[model samples]
Target chain A: MEALLYNLTYGFSVALTLENIFYCFSGVFLGTLIGVLPGVGSLATVAMLLPLTFALPPVSAIIMLAGIYYGSEYGGSTTSILVNLPGEGSSVVTCIEGHPMARQGRAGHALAIAAIGSFFAGCVCTLVVAIFGPLLASVALQFGAPEYFSLMVMALTCASVVGGGSVLKSLAMVTLGLLVGIVGTDVNSGIWRFAFDLWTLADGISVAVVAMGVFGLTEIIKNLGDDEIPPTLLQKKITGLMPRWKDLKQAFAPILRGTAIGACFGPLPGLGGTASSFASYMVEKKVAKDPSRFGNGAIEGVAGPESANNACSQTTFIPMLTLGIPNSGTMALMLSALTIHGIAPGPQVMTSHPDLFWGLIASMWIGNAMLLILNLPLVGVWVRLLKVPYRLLFPVIITMMGIGIYSLNSDPADVFLMAFFGFTGYVVVKCRCSLPPMILGLVLGPLMEENLRRALLISRGDPTVFFTRPISLGFMIATAVLLLMFLAPVYRRARKVAPAEEEG
Target chain B: MRLKIKSTEDFWAGLIFFGIGLYAIYLAWDYPMGSALRMGPGYFPTSLGAILSAFGLAIIALSFRLELENPAHVPWAFRPWLVLCGTLVVYGLMMRFELGFVPSLMTLIIGCSLAHRDVHLLETALLSVFLTAACVGVFIYGLGLPFRLFWWSY
Candidate 1:
């Protein structure tokens, strides 16, 4: 207990430096700005800003990037409440009750409750990370090559199953990503595997380039293609920024439940804020005395899901920080950022760079606090930003993306590569394939292969060694169970449908 | 009897993956595949390629078994896609030839803005200038990145 406090104090000391604080504030500010925009997402924004962080110290860079992440959650709800259009996927649940609140002239109350709930959740989950992170890292330290490989397999399986879409397609995307990931020179031997004689291919494709293409460029292309009428902004003036005492009391329980639900789901692979928020919404509905009050401007509905979403976003970092396994594309981007700074993330990150680890936790609390301040009094500023036409905004985004890619290695080829990926991403999305699994595969592929080889070499080519080891065997079983759990439903559904088709 | 594809999206997606997987396997075949113990450079890739091909085949099979409800009719944004990609390619080529940041950035902004159906030339030109100035000020003056602002020997 005393040691944790001392470590926390040390963390605060590192995070309190003016330089780090400035970066943290900037990160949240940019995160909120892009989050409020309907077309842009936190993933694309992070990918676009990654090159800018190359010059900063690793601690400051990650602090800012982390701030952008949770800050976007807070911003996403604002749009959900105001426009009835979800700015981010996790905030879609907020629209169920938040928009009705706006329609009933309680936008201020809904927004205030959301911000407070998110703030409370953020603080609690920050503590959760502080306490649980080191413990998880310690456990991860015991993992051998076979265990790690099995764990990766389990993570990949979970990612594909929960990634939303056909399981078979998601798995294929993962394989494609793995192939793309191994496009450079082999580490074991000096031979070039998939370089295709291009000097640029020797270094492999940059994750930023892939992210820019798949997330950033693909987003713009998607927005352009979407011909749906733009959602009208709520014209009513928002008043009563503070929630009443009764309202706060009503929201308090939901917030607590949401935080608990979010913390539980967040650390799991592929189940992030969106799942937790939906789960919180269901729980709140079930627990409510008047279930019909939901979807009718229920403050509990607004509070619970928003808090759950924020908490989930915060906890998703656990797997990344502790195990060096990214459950989602956003985490993959964060991992790549750390890799770029020459910091290999995993169990050693805590012991080797204690300041980066603890300081980031401390800074998250500060960033959450900063978000509350930014979202509450300065909410009006973001509303005006919504009026910026997509045409004018898209050009600027394109310019930024182009410049961001070009600045990476001062090679325009990277920009072209981003374009190629953008087109590929568009086609991939058109085919109803999820991008997250592919991204996870891309990031984890090489690591998985390295562990597989090491594990095999240690066992003298004995493949059964994986099943013989207790931890590895457990992971393999877990993977099998997870795959079975997903496939069973699909198999049942297909059988039912096939019989009906034959009858027809 | 004609074998009809139940899910058109899945069929195309499966074909793409299957093609890529086969290509990956073909490429990895040339590399020396050592034994499982002291694996050569080709071992992992060859295995991954085979696994990918299997996945691709599975997906192709699924496309025939599963039926899609309201198969999404995605209107391909050919113009936006082409213009945005062209803007990047053009910007890259210009930078490669030392066309300077200003011209390349202008081309990018102006070219991408054209992707929209309702483009005002005057407004787009202004946006291009304003954005180019902002980029130069922020990226060059603020961050001190190494970029030539114009085609001039400084």
Candidate 2:
């Protein structure tokens, strides 16, 4: 505890520098801005802004990016409450209760509770990361190739089961992503595997290009094809931005429950913010005396899920910072950011880069505090931003995307590659195939293959070695358990099936 | 006329997966596939390709098992597909030719805005100018990216 305090103080000393603070504020402010916009999401925004970070110091860049990450969580709920359109995947739950609250004269109430709950959850989860990050890193130090590979397997399977789509489609998407991930020159051998004689393909596809293409460009196409203009649900006046005392009292238990759920799920390999929020919503509905009030304007509905999502988003850093493995696409993008800075994330990150680790944790607290200040009083400004039509906004977005892609390597081929992914993303979405599993596969497949190969080589090609190792065996058992858990529900209620649906 | 499948989603999804999987397998076939103890560059890719093709086959089988009486309509929006993709192709070509930033950016904005009929020419032109200025300010002036605004030398 004493060491943690001392480390945090050192972290604050670094993060409190005027330049770093400015970047953090700018990140959260920009994050909230995009979160208010309908089509833009946290992942796409981070990908788009990644080029700018290359100019700053790595520490400042990461702090700013992390700020934008959780700050977007605050801004995401704003659109969901004001308009029925969720700015991102995790905010979809917020839309269920938040939009209803807006339809009534309780928009301010919903917004206020979301902000407060998020702030509370963010603080708690930041602490969780600070406490668990080092411990998890130590545990990860014991991980061999077999253990890491098994962990990745568990993550992919759990994500697929909870991914809430056709299991076959998700699996196919994952496999396709793995293929795409390996398209560059094989690292082991100097042979080009899937380059098709193109020089650029030898370097592999940029993660930013993939993200902007899939999330940003595909969203634009979908919105353009959508002829109907979404009616603003904020027809009622927001009387007050502060919730009543009774409402706060009613929200307290739900917020605590959400924080617990988020903290638990956030560090897991497969489950992330969206899954935690969905799980918290289920818990809230189950515990509530009037379960029927869930889909409506229940304050508890907004409080629990909003807090849960924020908690989950913060906890996502644990695995990324400790294990150097990403559970979600957003975390994968962050891992890419760390890599671009020539900092390999894993157990070594904590010991080798103490300033980076502690400073990031400290900056999260400051960033969350900054977000609460920006989100509450300035909620009206974000609501006004929603008035910009899709036509005017989309052109600017596409232009920025083009510019962002060009800035990466000055290769226009990257721009074309992004467009290709955009088309692919649209096609897959149309088919009701989840892109998260595919993205997870794309990000982790190469790493998994490397570990599996190493594990096999070490064990002299004994496939049974995976089952023989204790940690690896445990991970495989966990994966099997998760599979059975997801399947048993379907088997039990064959006729009435309600799978959890998520988009990342 | 295009071929209409009974299960449009499953059929198209399956076909795409199968095609990609088969192509991946073909590409990895020639590479050395050593034993698991001494894995070659091709070993992992070949196995993944095989698994992908198997998944593809299973999905196609599922299409038949879950066949619908009234087939799902395939709303393949070709106009957006052409215009959206064409914008990037044009932009890429312009960038390759060193046409500079502003012109290429204008092409992207103007070209993609045309995909949807609702865009006003005047408004789009205004947005392009505003965005170009913003990009030059933030990306060029602020971030100091070494990109010429107009390629004045040309």
Candidate 3:
């Protein structure tokens, strides 16, 4: 406890610096701006701004980048409230009640509740990190290759299950992602696996290129292809930024429940903020005295999912901070950012660079506070952003994406790769395949393979080592349980259908 | 009379996965597959290829069971596709030739305007100049990238 307080004090000293504060403010400001704009998400915005961070101190750079994340979460909820369009996947749940509330001219109430709930969740999660992060780091210090491999397997399985599509299709996407991940040179053999003689392919496809393509360009193309222009924002005047006392009372419990659920799920690999929000929404619906009110401007609906999403965003840093594992595509990008700054994230990050670790925690809290202050007063300004049409905005976005990819390594090949993935991503979207599993698979694949090889090397090629070790065995059991939970219903339904077919 | 593909998504998705899996297996065929105790690079790829093909087969099987809500048609928007691709290719070619940022950006904006139904030449031209100035200001002057504003600087 003393050590945590001492480390956190040191972190505050670093984060409280004038320059660091400036970076945090700027990052959140820009993050909120892009997040409020439909068709552009925080992931794309972060990818675009990644190059600018190359010039700053690593601590400031990471702090600013992280601020972009939470700031965008806040802004994403704003868009969900004012417009039916979700700024990102997690915010999709928020739009159910949030947009309905907007249509009913209670937009201000929904926006205020979202901000309040998110701020509360953010504060609690920061405390959770301060207390539990160090403990988890100590636990991670005991992990070896077998345990790591089992953990990745469990994460991948859980990720695929929660992805909410055909389980087979999600697994296929995961496999494709793993294959894509393997396109770079083989680390052990010094042989290129799938480079196909191109020097650019030798280094493998970059995360930024894939993310921008899948999320940004693909989204624009999909929007353009759709026959319908997006519905315009509710024209009613937003009244009463502060909710009634009774409404706040109703929301308080759901907010707390959401934060708890999100914090629990956040540290798990593969299952991220999106899953947590969805889970929280379900819980809120089930627990509400009147469950039917969920989709019809229920304050609890907006409050619960928004809080859960924010809490999940904060707690996700736990695994990344302690174990050097990313829980989602966005976290993968943050991990890449840390690697670019020459800081390897894992157990050693805390012991080796205490200030960077604690400073990041402190900066997040400050950024959340800034977002709350900025969101309420400037809600009107962000709503006006909805008036901007798709045609004018899309061209600018493409230009930015082009320039961003080029700036990464001054390689036009990256741009071409991005365009290729963009088209492919559009096709994948049309086919109803989820992108998250593929992304998670892509990020986790090489790491899992590296660990599997190391484990095998240590066990002298004993495949049974994973089953033999206690931690690895535990993780494998969890994976089995998750798979059965997800697949059991399908099996039951298939059996019933078979009987019906025979009788017919 | 014929075995028809019931689900277009599954058919295409399965085909793509199966093709990629086969290609992976073929690529890794020559790599040494050492014993599991001393695994070679080929071992993992081969295993993954087999697993992927299994997934493909599973999906393809499901295509027979699952019915489509509507017979799938090509989801392509030809004009947007052509204009977007053309603009990107032109921008890339210009960058490859070391054309000035202004000209390249103008080409991109003008080309992209064709994707929309209502194209105002005056508005597009104005948007081009504005966007070019903004890009130069932010990317070049603000971020201080190494790219020269004008090609003639060489």
Every candidate's lDDT: 0.85, 0.82, 0.80
> Candidate 3 at A11: error in angstroms?
2.0
Best TM-score among the predictions, by candidate number:
1
Error of 1 at A175 (Å): 1.4
- What are the runs in model 3 whose C-alpha is more than 4 Å off? A235-237, A242-246, A290-294, A490-504, B1-4, B67-74
Tell me the tens digit of each residue's lDDT in model 1 across B1-154: 6667888788888888888888888999888999999888888888888887887788788788677775558798988888888888888898888888899899999999998878999999999999999999999899887989778836
In Å, residue B80's CA in model 1 sits off its true spot by: 1.2
lDDT accuracy of residue B45 in candidate 3: 83
Interface RMSD of 3: 1.9
Model 2 regions lying over 4 Å from their true place: A233-239, A291-293, A486-501, B1-6, B67-74
User: What is candidate 3's lDDT per residue for A1-504, written digit by digit as tens?
Assistant: 787778778888999999999999999998898778875566666766666566688899899989887887778888878888776767888999999988988898898899889999999999899889989899988999999999888877776665455667778888888888888788888888778889999998877778777877676776677674565877556777877898799899999999999999888765666678878998999998999887899999999999998998899888878888776667777877787788977788988988788999999889899999999988878877778777777788788877877788887788778778877887787676777677767777788788888899999999999999999999999999988976687764543322110000
Cα shift from native, residue B119, model 2 (Å): 2.4
lDDT-wise, the better of 1 and 2 is 1
Interface RMSD of each: 1.0, 1.4, 1.9
The fnat of each candidate, in order, is 0.86, 0.70, 0.45
| A185: Cα error in model 1, Å | 1.7
Q: What is the TM-score of chain B alone in each candidate?
A: 0.93, 0.86, 0.83
DockQ of candidate 1 compared with the true complex: 0.84
